[model samples]
Target: MKMKPLGRTGVMVSDLCLGTMTFGTQTSETGGHRQMDMALAAGINFVDAAEMYPVNPISKETVGRTEEILGNWNASNAARRGDYVLATKHSGAGFSHARDGAPISGQTIPQAIEGSLRRLQTDYIDLYQFHWPNRGSYMFRQNWDYDPSGGDRDEVVANMQECLEALQAQVEKGNIRAFGLSNESAWGTAQWVRLADETGAPRVASVQNEYSMLCRHFDTDMAELSAHEDVGLLAFSPLAAGFLTGKYQGGSVPEGSRMSLVPEMGGRKSDRVFDAVAAYLEIADKHGLDPVHMALSWCRSRPFMTSAIFGATDEAQLQRILDGKDLELSQDVLKEINLAHRAHPMPY
Candidate 1:
């Protein structure tokens, strides 16, 4: 429940961000509200959501339901509107259910913001993020077939500039306080930063990407960019979609778990992922630590981390993670974790 600066935006955020992706799907509206209250009471001030959320099985039916839930909470909690930093995303192209399969572009920015604001029932968003780059991204298990050759540099930069202009308009209108990116690469982030600095638009304040014990892609180039560029990492799936929690370590998919619902685990299902989990679990056991706490605490230990985003289906799970919010791994434990990473790099 510690606060950190969000890039160069001067916005302060909690070290742990409560993710509401399961709000309308696995979690009921009441449950989601309770979770938010608990998170705020625990000193967590950052909450992240998206337009296309509640994704155990993302359908057209539930496309904007997550935002609506938060909106409802906001309507009732009018007095505490400014208590937390609220963030959400506009889905990129190929999200067929939203905007009829529209890609993120300057043309869509205004409309997207209007829709999100209406659904969120709020006047402004603390941080607004692009769900993905129109030029495509290597995150979400797409790294294996990642082909960056298709994007024309000029076209991509132009798009970012256009989007920045639109974002600047929103900022002027008091619609959003800061801007961010998701599922983006170091190169994509660089372009956004360059355009922002050159044009004096709202600089990219954060990048929300998948980062966990098994996924170390950000450890090198992205880490350097974050450290020097002042762009903090809003690490989604910091627990590896729950794999780092050890619930799926032995192929035991409990009934309501993400694996049981989506069996594929978003392409995270692999023998190697379990092998990686085992290695980390070993470190946790050796140090007499809860694997879930160990994984989250490990993320908290990273200097470039703005927040580690996590989701929970129920209060119990949420509290378990909250219990570990302040747990810090010792130097010895971190050394062993680094060794584990070297032993099992990119298991999925």
Candidate 2:
């Protein structure tokens, strides 16, 4: 339960963040609440959610249910509101369920924040993130075919300035304390930082992206940006959607598991992914480490990581990860991990 600074925002968050994406789906309301209690008891001080959550099967009908559940928790425990840092996201383009498929322009910022505030039963968010740029991103297994040639540089910067203006207004109105991004590239993050400095808008506090043993897209350029800029990485899917936990190994999908329900696992199911998981599992075995613990501890060991966001459907799964929250990997384990990464880079 180590705490780290969330960029230049001057807010401290736990080394591990509790992810509530499964609040209304895969996990029940009571179960989600129970997990929150356990997370807090374990000293986790950061909680992350999104408007379009419960994403095992994201549907319009259940779009905002996750935040509503969190709101309910906040309403009943009003006295504990200041005990933790709450973060949520504004969905960008390609999401048909929000604002009738509106993109995250200056026009959508206020509305999105209003909706999130209403649902969360909170006056202000500790961190508000753009889910992804309207320009699209390489996250969620889109890196292979990813193309960023859609927009002109000046036009993109202009749009960012407009969004920053809107965000500055939010900051002035006390709607959001800090700003962040998700599924962004190093260059995109730099642009946001540059614009914020130039326009007196909020500098980014974090970047929520998929970073795990199987996904090292953030290891190089993004790592450098995070190191110098102080925008620490909020790594989602630190378990690689259970692939790093070895649950989906040997083609055996456990009953009620994510892969059993959503076979594609958001395009994470592949032969290469399995092979990469095997390599990590082997390393863990060689070092007498639980693969789950190894994967999570490895994430926290990164220099640029502020927190590694993780989710679990039940308390047992949660407790197992919490038990290993303080594990410090040996130098030997890290060496094997680098070899594994070099062998299976970008398995997805």
Candidate 3:
């Protein structure tokens, strides 16, 4: 439960951030409250949510319920609201439910922030992120045919400038303190950084991407940029959507789990994913370690990682992850993991 600086913001955040994507859907409001209480009591001071959360079903009705649940907690525990760092995102285009599928622009920035602040019951958001690049991203199983060539460079730069200016206005108005990115590539992040620098607006503070033992795309170019530019990574799905937790082994989809709720598991479900997960689970077992611990602790050990974002349906699952906050992977274990990655890289 140790704290780390979030980029160069002068703000300290817990190494383990409580992810609330399941707050109002798979997990009830009571269960969500219990999870938050346990995480805070156990010294976790960071919580991440989104405007389009409770995402197993991801319906319009339930889109912002997760933030609302957190907002209710903040309102009920006003004295403790300042004790934690609250982060949420503004959903980009393609979801007809959010802003009628409008791409993130100057108009949508204020519109999204107002709703998020209202639902979160907070005046200032600790971190406000673009859910994904409006142009598109290679994330969520889109890497195969991903192409940014179709986008207009002039239009994209114009949008970034306008959006960054709008975000700066929000900062001036005390609605949001920081800006970040999600599901972005190195090129996409670079454009944001360049625009921010040229405009004297807020530099991108962090990038929340899917980084797990099964996913290593961020290890190369993104790692280098983060190291030099101070845009730390808020790694989401450190467990690879519970695949690294060892619960989904043997092709068994446990009832009430994420896989059970969304069989495709947001495109992480594939024929090759299980074998990749098994290899890591074997390495964890060989080292007499819990797979969850090996997965989470390994993320913390990374040089440019600010925090590992993980969600839990209940307190037991949350405790299982928290117990490994201090566990460190031995060099031998790390070597084995790397060897396994080489054997079956990009399983999903």
lDDT at 290 for candidate 1?
Answer: 97
By lDDT, highest first, what's the ranking?
A: 2, 1, 3
**Candidate 2 ranges with C-alpha deviation above 4 Å:** none
lDDT of each: 0.92, 0.93, 0.91
User: Rank order by TM-score, top first?
Assistant: 1, 2, 3
For residues 39-146, write the lDDT of model 1, one tens digit per residue.
999999999999999799899899899999999999999989899999999998888888887878888999999999999999999999999989888998999999
Worst 10 contiguous positions by lDDT, candidate 1: 151-160
* C-alpha lDDT (0 to 100) for residue 272 of candidate 2: 93
> Which residue pairs collide, candidate 3?
none
Instruction: List candidate 3 stretches off by more than 4 Å.
Output: none
* Clash statistics: count for each candidate: 1, 0, 0
Q: TM-score of the candidate numbered 1? A: 0.99
Q: Give a tens-digit lDDT track for model 2, residues 141-208.
A: 88989998888999899999999999999999999999999999999999999999887888999999
